[model samples]
Target: MEYILAKYNYWIYILLMMIGLYAMIAKNNLVKKVIGMSIFQTAIIVFYVSIGAKRGASIPIIAHGHGHDVIATAVSAAEYANPLPHVLMLTAIVVSVGTLGVALAVCLAIYRRYNSLEEDEILEQLR
Candidate 1:
């Protein structure tokens, strides 16, 4: 129980991913599937962010401009957190938004063409 309590974020991320996967795989509506995809992407983003975070850690940047013309403060790497994961996650967020926009546009196009959003209804019309 102590271990589970310490890693509850992981469990929440898993639950969110499962919910998104189920919606994408089991739902009939194209819009719902797109929403599920977004949800899945969000869960992944949160997971990465959570993994990148450390308790009581400061940013990687060092400050040295306080009442001195020379660099006087020195901080080891252990004192700062790595910013790569968070930076990459920012890029991922932009890409996810773009993908969601394109996917919803595609869904809109499908609805216009078939007059429906249900996958089965669209397939029946195609047949």
Candidate 2:
């Protein structure tokens, strides 16, 4: 119970991932699938960003010193957490949005061509 409560973010991420996967696999609507993909990507991004966080730690910036031994004392990694994962997640978010836009545009094109946005209906029309 303690572990579950302590790691609640993991549970939330897992739940979101499952919901997205279910929508992508079971939902018949193309738009819904795209939305699911976006949700999944968001969950992954959130997981990465959250995991990168350090408790009681400061940012990655090194503390400036007035003495000559600034590099030795100020660069200790024990007090600061790396911010790369969070930065990478920001890039991932941009890419995900662009991908979602392209996916929705493709769904729109398919709807324009078939006059329907449903997977089953499109397959039936193709048959």
Candidate 3:
């Protein structure tokens, strides 16, 4: 029970990721697949951000205009939340948005050409 309580967030994220994966794999509609991809990207971003979280930690930024002696003694690595994961996630978010846009555009083109969003219909049209 204690283990489950402590790691509930991880379990939730895993469940979300699995849902996205299922949607991507099992859905027949192009739009639904695109939405699933977006959900998968979101789950990845959330998981990364969650990995960076620290209990009793402050932001990574340092205050300016404070005395050098005070600053030197007051700041420590343990006191600040990990910033690398956050920064990487920001980049991932931008890339995800761009990818989503491209994916939607492709789906739009597919819809325009075939007049259907269903995978089976598109394959039939292709044949």
Candidate 4:
């Protein structure tokens, strides 16, 4: 029970990822596939952000006082949340947005060319 409480967020994210994977694999419509891809991307982003979270931690900022001669104190790593994952996730989010835009544009072109968004229909038109 304690383990479950501690790791529930991971489990939820995994469930979301599975749902997205299933939709991408089993759905008939191109739009549904795109939606599933977006969901998968979102799950990844959330997972990364959650990984960076620290209990009883503060933001990664330094506080300054009005004394230049004051002795510098060592900062503990555990007192601050990890910023690397957050930064990487920001970049990932931008890339995911661009990818989704390109995918939707391609879907639009496919729909215009074949007059259908279903994979079977598109394949039939190709053949």
- As a TM-score, model 1 comes out at 0.87
What digit string (tens of lDDT, one per residue) describes model 3 on residues 1-112? 9999998778888988999999999999998999999998888888988899999888877656266566555557787899999999999999998999999999999989
lDDT of each: 0.88, 0.87, 0.89, 0.90
Which portions of model 2 miss their true places by more than 4 Å? 59-78
Query: Estimated TM-score per prediction?
Result: 0.87, 0.83, 0.88, 0.86
Which candidate has the highest lDDT of all? 4
lDDT per residue, candidate 2, 1-127, as tens digits?
9999998888999999999999999999998999899889988987887788787788766667566766565365667776889789889988988998899899989999999999999999999
Q: On TM-score, who's better, 3 or 4? A: 3
Which stretches of model 1 miss by more than 4 angstroms?
59-72
Q: What residue runs in model 3 are displaced by over 4 Å at the alpha carbon?
A: 64-74
The residue pairs that clash in candidate 2, if any, are none
Please identify which of the two predictions, 2 or 4, would achieve the higher lDDT against the true structure.
Answer: 4
- List all candidate RMSDs to the true structure: 2.3, 2.9, 2.1, 2.5
Query: Which 10-residue window in model 3 sums to the lowest lDDT?
Result: 65-74
Of the candidates numbered 1 and 4, which has the greater lDDT value?
Answer: 4
For candidate 1, what's the RMSD?
A: 2.3
Highest TM-score against the true fold, candidate: 3
**By how many angstroms RMSD does model 4 differ from the true structure?**
2.5
Question: TM-score for model 3?
Answer: 0.88
Residue 67's lDDT in candidate 4: 71
